[model samples]
Target: MSTSVALAAALAGFALGFSMIVAIGAQNTFVLRQGIRREHVLAVVAICALSDVVLISLSIAGTGFVLGALPWLMTVVRVAGALFLGGYGVLAARRALRREADALSVSGAEPDAASRRRSLLAAIGTCLAVTWLNPHVYLDIAIVGSLANSHGDARWLFGAGIAAASVLWFTTLGFGARMLAPVFARPLAWRILDALIAVLMLTLAVLVLLPLFTGSGS
Candidate 1:
């Protein structure tokens, strides 16, 4: 690709990746939790970025049409994702309410290191499932990738550029947030983060469910 096209592709990819992921959701929440605990950050980031790569690749390779052909599949995904989001939102809100005095200590938790390690791995697995199992990820990747391909760019190059953006953004988010672990060590800060997470999850659940009710009315 020419320098100008490559630059454009890279910028486009970065913008799309950032925009899609910057929202607060289960995946980002899990990543932030891992960051705070200072464990398995890279592994969690890898799962997220790699999942995006695979989904975006499938989207660019004409799988977008196949997904489009299965409207019921999308409906199934929408319902399942909504339920998951809502359930997670309730848990977050419950955490917000419990609001223990010592909830945010980074170094004081007494679990054995092995147990902590397993918890980190479990968190990573959950993040991967939340990102990969959601149907909207496929819709965004496939639609965006196919649109980029229509611009006559090399297909593999386009997908690679987009995938690179995913890798870069999630890695930064996972690691960069960990850099703030000191600040989050404060119980008050942890409370604020948990409250914020609760609101974000509930807001997203509302966004998901509003369409269903509205569409039914129309």
Candidate 2:
């Protein structure tokens, strides 16, 4: 690929990845919590970053064609994803409403090592589900990847650029946000964060389900 083309592809991929990920959602909330607790932060970030890598790789490799061919399958995934998001949103809202100050504190400051380990595992699992189980992620990566591949540039180079962008974006989001852990450690701050997350998750779920109920977007 021409240097100009490669540069353009990289910039485009970076913009797309950052735009999609830099939002309040389950994955971001979990990462933020882990960062505040200062437990297994790197592992959580790694899991989030690697999940994006695998998904983006599949998208670039043309596996997204399967999603295009199986329309019914995507519908099922969409419904499941919506339900998951809604349930998570409710939980977040409940936490905010309950206002359990102690529960919101940074877990495992000293003697609660076992609790910290479990929390780390739970965070990793949640991040994986939030990243992998959402049908929209597949649509974004695959549909976008397919279109980029069709643009007559070197396919491999374009795919590489996109994948690199994913890595960069997630790494920054997961780790860079650690700097704000002290601020979020405050109970009021967590309450606000959880409330915002609830709103974002519910909004996304409604957006996903509206098309299904109306049958207008299909």
Candidate 3:
């Protein structure tokens, strides 16, 4: 591939990856909440971006397609993912009830009964779950993997570009969230955000489960 062709392929990969991930979804919502809370921001970002890195790389190498042949794998993921997402949604709804919970949630402050401690490790684990458990994630890998493979020998360049997009987008989302801190500083904003997160997670869980019930989109 000529230099121009390589760069073009990389840019195509970057645009495709960025566009796919920029949409509103459970993972994005969780990232936004972590960013606003200023809790475990780096870990959240790292987990999300790194998960995408693995998925994208698998896609580029064409391993992602092989996973699609196993319907049982998706079935297992669907059940587990629904349970996790439903539980998280319940927790978020509980947090929403405690309107007094501080947005900043400073340490040593009187803790609200409905509020749970948000630890870095917990955040990392949650991000990992949200990224990995979703059946939609594999579909993204399968789709993008084909796109990258289309670049033929230049697929490495394409993969690198997709990885770069993941890094840049998540970094901006996790860090750029601070810019909205002033707005989210209010307790009501926190409640609204948590409520939205709850709904988003729950809805995604239902969508994942719907396939099992209706046998569509599997």
Candidate 4:
């Protein structure tokens, strides 16, 4: 491909990828919470971006065809993801209700090593689950990959652009959230945030399972 065509394809890919991921969802909400808490922010951002790269690459490699051949697999994933999201939503709701448990502290003192390690592990595990378990992610990859492939010889460049978009977006969201630390200092602010997360998560869980129940492959 000529240089102008390649650049255009890459820029198009970046725009599509950024638009797709900028929406508020389970993964974004979790990342926002981790960012605000200042707990494992880099790890969470890495997982989100890296997972996108892997998924996009696999889709470009024709994994979407394999997935299409096994429609039942998507059904299984949808059910599992809905259940997981529902459980998480309940937890967020509980946190919102219990002020003592949901307090957001901005103190400079850090947790001990053991506690920090455990928290880090938990955060990483949750981030992975949120990213991987969502059936919508595969659908997105298929869409993006199909679009990128339309660019002919510039497809790889397009995929690379998508990856770049993921990295840029997650980095901005994870680090920029700290700017709102002052606003989240109050315990009530934490409660409000948790409550919003709870609602969003539960709603997403319902949406994920809706197609299965309604018999519409929306």
Candidate 5:
């Protein structure tokens, strides 16, 4: 009976985590961009998945109480996230409008060693910022942690399931994106993708700040 309960809790956690994360959001958008570009895909995916693990663990450990005690923290994160998303959206829009012929290639361009190193570092920094600065991540962590705790002894199992989901989803998104390289080989396809990503990011930025302006809890 105990083992069955644990399994059930684990499944529930995975379902909830996957559902929440599968939605189109700023973090996921960034990951998809990196994947499509084939730019440090492994590092980007690792940062995203590991960041989820740390946030969920902290939430389960009751660190979320800190945010509750300090309401201003959420506000800071909200504003910063909105700014970041808005900036990225503008950049994407510019890319979409550029006249230069740019398209994906399976054999992608190879930069010099120093250039590759610098680009890798930049990608890592952006990945960390994107993962950490999102207000939605904290909200999701809070929900997941609270639900996990409801399972009593099965809480750890539940968290493990969530961790598994994070790893699986990010892995699939990062690596599976390569399959689309053929379609993105067309410059028009690249433009369309960048345009869509720009709209998504800008919309998410407004959504992140909506609660603040309306004085409603998200």
Candidate 6:
């Protein structure tokens, strides 16, 4: 019965973690693109997956207490995150409009050692920004933390399960993206993707501002 409980907690953790993360959003889009481009794909995946692990672990270890102690912090984060997401949305929209040319440039560019190194660094920086700046991350971590603790002494195992989910998802998304390279080769696909990204980002920005709009800042 004890073994069963631990397995159950781990499975629950995996399911919840995957469900929360398997969404289309700014961070995912950026990661997907990096994967498709094969530009620092490993680094981007590592950063994203490891960041999730750290955040998840911290939350399980009582970051929620810190968040609870400073409830106003989330409000500030929400406002800043909304602004940042909105800005990125606008940038995505612009990219959608010019995707044809951008795709052409991407395809035409030659990858040299120096260029590859620069691309790797740039991709890592972008991945960090995408992962850290999004308010959704904090919310998810808090929720996951709460869920993990629900398992009592099994929460650590649960946390490990969720961390594994992060690793699996990112590894698959980053590497599996190559399989879709043929379809994305068309500039039209890139345009559509960017347009969708723009819409998603803008929608997230609006949702994040709901607290301010409803006069219930949480």
Per-residue lDDT tens digits of candidate 5, residues 58-124? Answer: 9888867777778788899999999988988999899999999688765657789999999999898
Top of the candidates by TM-score: 4
lDDT of 6 by residue, 5-26 (tens): 9998888888877887888887
Which residue segments of model 6 deviate by more than 4 Å? 104-109
> Per-residue lDDT for 11-93 in model 3, tens only?
98899888888998878888988887787788889889989888888888877668778767778878888998999999989
Output the worst ten-in-a-row residue range by lDDT, candidate 4.
99-108
Q: TM-score of every model?
A: 0.84, 0.84, 0.90, 0.96, 0.95, 0.90
Residue-by-residue lDDT tens digits, candidate 4, 1-218: 69999999889889988898899999999998888888899999999999999998998888877778888888988998999899999999998999484556755687899998999999999999899999899778678768888988898889988899999999999989888888888889999998999999999999999999899743
Candidate 2 per-residue lDDT, tens place, 109-161, comes to 56577887887777777777787767678678666668667756555555566
Model 4 spans > 4 angstroms off? none
Clashing pairs in 3: none
Of candidate 1, the 10-residue stretch with the lowest lDDT total is 99-108
RMSD of 3: 3.3
Clashes of 3: 0
Give candidate 2 misplaced runs (Cα > 4 Å): 1-4, 102-113, 151-153
Query: lDDT of all predictions, in order shown?
Result: 0.73, 0.73, 0.83, 0.89, 0.86, 0.84
lDDT of 1 by residue, 88-167 (tens): 77876776677476344645558888897888777766786678656567678567767668757655666676788778
lDDT accuracy of residue 149 in candidate 2: 74
Q: What's each prediction's clash count?
A: 0, 0, 0, 0, 0, 0
- Model 6 poorest ten-residue lDDT run: 99-108
